[model samples]
Target chain A: MNRILRLFAVTLIAVVLVEVGYAIPSFSRKYKTSCSTCHYAAPMLNGFGKAFKNNGYRYPAGTDPEMTKEEPVSLGSEGYKKVWPEAIWPSDIPGTSPLSIWGIGRINYAAMNDVKWEFEFPHEVEILYAGTIGENFSFFGELEFENEDNQNEIMYPFALQYDWSPGLHIRAGMVHADPTPNHLKLTRNHYNIASFRSRNRWRFRDEQIGLEVWGAGNGSGERGGYTYRAGVVNGQGINDMNKEKDIYGKVTYKIGGLGETGGTAGAESQTSEFFIDNSVTVGGFFYKGTASRAGFNDEDFTIFGGDVDYWYDRFIVNGALMFMNSGMPGIPERKSMVYYLQGNHVIYPWLIGLIRYEWEDADTDQDAVKPVNAFIPGVTVMARANVKLVLEFKMFLDDVNKKNDTFTLQMNFGL
Target chain B: MNRIKIVVSISLLFLLSQPLFAGDIKGKVKAKGVKHSGDAVVYIEKIDGKTFDVPKDHAKMDQKNLTFIPHVLPVLAGTTVDYLNSDEVLHNVFSPETCVDKFNLGTWPKGQIRSYTFKKSGCIPVMLCNVHPEMEAYVIVLETPYHGVTAKDGTYEIKDVLPGKYELKIWHEKLKGASVVVEVPEHGEVVVNFDIKR
Candidate 1:
């Protein structure tokens, strides 16, 4: 090899070493508690994870940095907080209720040969807050920017959260119907699954405009182990609504010893014990699109699915299967199903290994189609209660795919 | 006539000596640094080697408004705690571990009462409603009756503490362990303030 080629190879090797070396400890410290605590599995965000995201990823950072090397500085730290205390501030106003900041960053690198390498640097930073002036009403706004498309263009997840009663809450926001197990994009990065545009041009706004009603069961044995959420969305994505929009709804039911719903390990998460130790969710959505659109041809579409999640101590296994059939002709009258068999073991009190085999296939590959088979294996290390680092390896099996194998390294700390 | 007189005399002597040794050991147990509106039980245990007995009528736990009325209730071994759920919804009560009586009462609807008799008391625990995972109540069963729950302002005043060399102990739901200990002089009201550490 010539000198230039040798230099390129050396640089590539150095980057890979850093990435792999950093990833080793990253996997060892991501889920220090238990897998059942934060996720049903990969791409499956449990109740606690949702709260952490909604709160802009802020969580109580206990004392552990002194003992562990991967413990990232928290929002309370002098260096990080001083530079960005309002992690996702709107830049509109200052000095109002102490700005709250949320951020997620992804660093990816892949090497195919001695002279070729692919790299992507994308991150999302947001600032948001929710305030209430009176009973039954609250307003929330989240401004976010991603590096892939626009440099500083903002995407807002704005909405109003209403408390209808002790058992029910309603939210009307420009929000996605929460990317469940089926909706998640299979990718190496931990922050995001995948984008429809990455594979196809006319794919946007999987979010629909709608209202969601959610409730927790009262302690009665008959109703205790269930959490129900249902809503009617635009049947498209978010932010863009057309006249052909349809109503969508989803209901999730979890049955287990109390506190299991929150996916945490103490009284802070669950309030009761388990007489009926199990949890299951079944949901279906329908959309009526009569207007003419560019991507969608017909006037109607419907999606139906059911998710079953069970938690037995340190082991939690869950699977979700959804079917979407578009009324538009020449759309292959699609039936798409994505399912995974996941197992999580608490290696120790603070170390966790989560392995999952995922498969996503559709009836037709018309536009923006994803791979049919994906073998994903991931490990996370929860060095402490508040700090986590994750390392994931994703292998795609297909001839028309480049960058067939990918590795992801991520570190997250809240509060 | 002689046998009856002997039995009656023995019974009278046993009753006469009970008050002297036991001495109505009445005192209130209090916890500090809690702000939520709830109650907790305070308990006392006598160290007779490894054996102890909790008074039957001394321990009680209550649930109201879908929350444990007293968040903490300390009790002794072999004690019967009245687990009352006063909320409009039904409550199923059980503890997965650390107690012998792990029974679920199904659904006890509004304005109803159910009771559980704790036979083996080593730190008997109580949890509520498998459905309402946010509704939690704790009953810490010890081996003595020398415990009391804290008041609204985090102040606990244990009254009628028998004047003796007694080891005073305190506990809280969030507190890690016993707050502190003190010695009580005979017929003396000792003011012990516990600054519970998180």
Candidate 2:
């Protein structure tokens, strides 16, 4: 019965994709522009796209009304700005609905020691809301539904942000704790350093409910500059387990390529935003938090990580190293070291090839056979500006997962 | 024999003396799904045996206040266009359309000018600035000089076109209009109207 159900779902999704016609609309429909303006592929932003995101979902020049095709409905008139304290400040809402629907579906075939080729669909259907409320206020939200263990699992993450300038902003709600540029990766899998959860369930990539101040400064493109973010949160991902708060901070310095806000006038790429990025960005991050359980021994952990990204024309490569320990006050038996190196090249405007090597040493074990060591290779094909397909194979080299290698073919799109 | 030759010469002169027929074509285009009906290029497509002289003076397009002045420009083939940057900041121009050779004009400060000649007819290229992705314009290269730009009221007129059966076409960046077959008579006006849709 489970096998039949999976096959039915795959056929149904394929039919729906064909009937929906070309493109999955989002910002493109609102601004009356093509998806290629921001995305090298769906969800993987390019140089100008980074600037757009950094500027709080509006154009980098700070909320240009002319940038949008439909004029937003004004809550009050522009005259209210001149009157100031005499009247309340006015704002505008999107002329069209801000909500956008997109989804990801994967058909996987796995090979393991005890099982012949098994089938599991890694599925996600999401509704995303993102836009600027006015000149200064912006918000982003994602309501995601996933299929896990033949059950529907749901999660919603959101952020409300305020823009003060091109260089500074403040935000609240679920915000990322690291500055790893995970959105730039072409693969479907998360970086090992970003997702490797300690026994306490502490993860670096998880979004935490928190307040944060972040900024990107210096319009230096080929010349170097920096962007930094810091926040204080309850430490837990979705629910609070204790009254103590967790704090995390990250900073990155870009040595070349397009800057956080813009780029040099003549030096910028005229052909493609993705391929022409030539830069080296080095970053460091840290998170300190404590885990508590009912009638159990408590542990305080501190995680330190460093990463470097190199972009040379059509090629991009990244390396991350992380160390986490609960021995801050001399507690033993809890420590881990992890690292991953990934590289990708844009073979064509519609194709990309990538490979990643991940290694982890958990529980401070010096075992001759490492349990978590693997290599991943993948290719992404963008059939349209909004529809993408990725095929990946994860091969484990350790004694534990040597016979549990997996391969995945995934389709991702957004409207 | 001398008289016969003179008569033949007189008959040939009479045949050559017949005047070429010419007339004006006027029309109105109702464009749907846009604020204005103007900016649509209405022209006669290439007539197999016809050729018109290219205008010697160059057409001008200006970048001022980070906006492209005259968002749409229609020019005859073999005509040169002078792109002028009138803003204080630097700006560059490039088009991705392969029909136009995919040319790029490097960035320059205010008061500088660059030139490109439209050698291919029927090439419509969307012009863009690398520095300002929001800035855009279009250059429509036509094969014949006989064309007219629609007014705010969607009315247009092509004057002194050689009288013949021709295809009168309408082009809008976002709207599709039907082409009409027009038969023009000597010194007379032919009206061809269109209703373009989304």
Candidate 3:
């Protein structure tokens, strides 16, 4: 590879290294409950957590008033809703501070073929805020600080959401535009397809500034139900100079489990595994965007994917497949694909064991580039309700002789 | 002489069957470490040689406005209690206690009643509903009918206690109080106060 290309890859990898999963503990404070109430662990939501998200961060059964331990402060009066034209609509803000702080400390080991390997530590920090606004509105925001090249860089992503119904809602601002799960990934590195970037730098994990409409509902008694979301985003990510906008849509259906309702758990997360229900969720999504450049002709790319998640007893298995089609004006059009299969077992409520296999077939016709195959086996331990410890060993199947294996240990705490 | 002897025997039997010298046990209870001292149960332990008949009437606990109307209800052992749902929404009643064999009354609509009988004396069971977990109440089953719940001011009175030396106990869901031996005086009210702690 050329020096410039190698440098770009290294920079991107460094950026991804600091991208850790975020678990908001502010809700726990507001509810006066433990983090286990909504998370299998922080960031990896269980059935109830999914339902809670679908309801715009409110209780799904419309029992917020009864379940909320801490009452919210009202911004406007309910008496004003009847006089809309003459008065502002009523809503409530969190009674307590809605902010949560997360610190990530890590030790990384790489068996490098060229460069000296050293352990990395205390890589990133983030300030996160998520809470409900009144009855039908909610918001989530995060400010991320990372250490790279001996410098601290900051990035902020946030969104405001409004719930129209259980089957429909609207969200605006910087948001995750893909149908597949990325923001909530348990692994240090995002799924291959979600992190895949084209030559023009269009990565799915980049929080796109956009507007999305989504909805979900629990049918009945763990029968699960449906979830659908679609969005129109600035295809080039934040602060795009081009007029072209990207659009994507996704739909999912889950059966025989607490898809999103989590009625028994009552919109609460993993509070415990005793309530884990058997479920199968299937989904499909597509993203079409144009990558613009000043000197060269614009390139258009489209990615279509299908994903599935299965939960049975203490085991959860999930997989995704994505096919990408790209047209770069001076070169011949190319097609590529990335896919991964993963499984997780609840060895204990505090301990999780997982294995993932990923393969990337780039430029089908390019014989010079061999398919990249890898295996990532990891274990996550809950040091406490608010602390998590993860250890992952990743091995590249195609580069075993090149001594390119990597292992990472990360400690994340939120308060 | 034979007729007079029979009449006297019958009269003695009738007098023995009645509570000739009964008194009222009334007092103030100070439940420490809590907001309100109300709902604490004060009752007399079972008599050594006596057992009251199970009341034919049923005790009623009403669910209204997402709350249990009577937070604490004491009933004689083997008494049937009616769980009534008066809320607009459906309500369910279940207990995790083994006293009532973990009785579960499934969801019911407004104005419906589900009943369960507590047959074990000295069994205290918490009633809960899956529909509204916050709604909680306690059922205190006792062998004696002499029981009273303290008012908000912490005053309680168990009337018509037969003259005897008996154990008087206080039961609070979140607090514990020491039991005392009380000697009842015939035909009068006894003022016994108690202090409960966490």
Query: Which candidate number has the best lDDT?
Result: 3
DockQ of each: 0.06, 0.09, 0.09
lDDT for each of the candidates? 0.46, 0.75, 0.79
Per-residue lDDT of A209 in model 2:
77
Ranking by lDDT: 3, 2, 1
Models 1 onward score TM values of 0.53, 0.79, 0.76
Indicate the residue-level lDDT of A231 in model 3.
92
Best by TM-score: 2
lDDT of 2 by residue, A1-415 (tens): 9877876665443321111111225567677766766666667776656666777776645435656777789989888999989888999988888888877788776686354454455487877787878789988877666666465555667789998876788999866675454456667777787678766655666556789889886445324467788999877644566777888898888887666665344442334443455778899998888766555555688888889988887888889898888743344556789899998888987899999999988866546536498999999998876788999999999888897888888898777
Kindly report which residue stretches of model 3 are placed more than 4 angstroms away from their true locations once superposed: A1-22, A113-122, A148-150, A182-184, A218-222, A259-275, A292-298, A400-402, B1-163, B169-177, B184-189, B196-198
RMSD of each: 13.3, 9.9, 7.6
Fnat measured on candidate 2: 0.00
Q: Candidate 1: DockQ?
A: 0.06
Rank candidates, TM-score, best first.
2, 3, 1
How do the candidates rank by DockQ, highest first?
Answer: 3, 2, 1
Candidate with the larger TM-score of 2 and 3: 2
Give the per-residue lDDT of model 2 (tens digit) for B92-111: 78888998889997665457
Query: Per-residue alpha-carbon lDDT of model 1 for B22-113, expressed as tens digits?
Result: 32233343333556412534444554554544554745566553456666666566777776655432355767654655666554544556
